[model samples]
Target: MSAPTPSARVTLAELAAEAGVSLSTISKVLNGRTDVSRTTRAKVEVLLDEHGYQRRGTRTPKSRLLELVFHELESAWALEIIRGVENVASENGLSVVLTESGTRHAPGPEWVEGVIARQPAGVVLVFADLPQDCRRQLESRSIPFAIIDPAGDPAPDVPSVGSANWAGGMMATRHLIDLGHTRIAAITGPADVMCSLARIDGYRTALNAAGLPFDRQLIRYGNFHVDGGRDNALELLRQPNRPTAIFAGSDIQALGVLDAARQLGISVPGDLSIVGYDDLQVARWSSPALTTVHQPLIEMAEEAARMVLMLREGEEPNNLRLDLATSLVVRQSTGPAPDAVRPLAAVG
Candidate 1:
């Protein structure tokens, strides 16, 4: 029945003075910089513990940092998500280091490893397709992480937060159907991505519900980029049985579809109706205006950041499969399917 002795408080300068090193050296050592000698590092470490001094306002063990890995920063989608993440992280007094995976081809493994080695309090994966090697490294280290718009086969242990892409797809298709279009085609992202597959499934689901046959020819694959959409749309238009309406998976692709339609001299909503997903800012500014399925990008990002913070604190997130709803925005680009017209000369 004895009270424990209060530990003495020590500052960085005090530690440096005792260890016979400069304040900068002490700061570098504490921050895990590699410039300090082993003897100096050891001496500083012993004093830090002896004084029971904790670094001001950070997670235990003095590293109050997190890592956020994104697929592409150039995209408005990613930028919105990052804004959400930054807001949450800042509110929580956590420092977040962001890195982009670049285009699908340039996933820098070294950068991921460096982040992992830094031993962040947690990690937020913003729409990046995690490789097996990276997944393995994260798992082995028991790092707390959450995937936003998870593309790979995520382990059950790690949670993910994203909009229900399949539902978004179904909603988009249904909107076209409600507008009196039956011959609807779909331009989708890479087959490897789970979101793309889910979207395809949703499209099929809507078609099946309406008793419409699922035509394989109507489905085209793209890289979720404008050029890919343009190429695929050109092929779709070339077919003898062209669709009256098209549902593009992303806003960027939808822009390409519009370009292709223009090149083919087809009038939007007159010859072809178009709808796109992601409801990005460009959708509003597009020439005929774009009807799109709106995903709550900012909310999704905020939720993912909150999830990472919770995981870092060893808290189980309540909603494992957070399926945010999607809304269909109506615009001038979509209308009733074009009607078959007889030649004026023949009629006369």
Candidate 2:
């Protein structure tokens, strides 16, 4: 007798109830999420082989395209990430489709609906705060997703790729402290972002480690952009006791900090020192060449793309959370603290 195909006999819903797990759990077992325990995988595998079941449906699958969505695709930073994704996608014979969320940090309702209509094999979200409904919709359809540098906490079962943000922050801050700069300030990414919050925590931890008090006034939130860095740096510089060194959350912001300092006639690494994050191409070209923490943005993007492809091929990752290492890259923008520049009037 011939065996019954997935569409012919048992459905995933029936198998989920039989196994006493949620639909998502069954989907994870099929698509290969490493978070599922070994015992659970064995149980699901037994049932799958017993029933000769395969995936959610037995129909011919959707197109061989993968979706890459971003909050906003601008800046050299975004371009680097794009290049990584494109490299992997093209090599695997899969086309890439790019989407921008426009005004919001995550895709809107309309965007999600459009994705459902198109039904790509999988998705990669960069700096997106995945909405609960969006997650449910994708899971329901067995459309896998992996996040790159998620803006907020990702779903517990979802795979994600990012650098060691906390370590990067600590390293950047400690470099300044080691340079004998006691008056150090940090301009971090948005307050709501998970990576931003982690980076700030590392900053505070480093200060506390050095027996320095955490000064609330010295901390400011930027939007991971140049303007935000520039404006915030301007404010910090105008204070009566301006910081001798400033750590901007991103390279773009670091350049903006340099701009602000130039406008005030302050010399880089002479009157002031600057440190930035995400050692991008511009970081090397900035007037003084930025000292920064390398965040491995391209590598993370590439990993995310590869994960999506693996999900499409029905392979589980060896690990669910992949974090690349970050290290400090010293350049001309940083030096020993200046002796003469102690206080500031206002730079209007």
| Segments in model 2 whose C-alpha atoms lie over 4 Å from true places | 1-62, 102-105, 342-348
Each candidate's TM vs. the true structure? 0.75, 0.79
Q: lDDT tens digits, residues 1-348, model 1?
A: 121244555667887888888999877655566677878866776666555544544444555777888767776687787788888878978788888864553347656547645877778886444554455445434466777773444545557777878888899999888877888999998888878899999999999999999999999887889997899988888666788899998989999999988888778988899998898888999989999989888788788888877766668899765767778899889998778521222110
How far is 19's C-alpha from truth in model 2 (Å)? 25
List model 2 lDDT by residue over 156-178, tens digit each.
56788878888988999999999
Q: Considering summed lDDT, which 10 consecutive residues are worst modelled in model 2?
A: 53-62
lDDT of every model, 2 decimals: 0.77, 0.81
Estimate the overall C-alpha local distance difference test score of candidate 1. Answer: 0.77
Highest-lDDT candidate? 2
Residue pairs clashing, model 2 = none
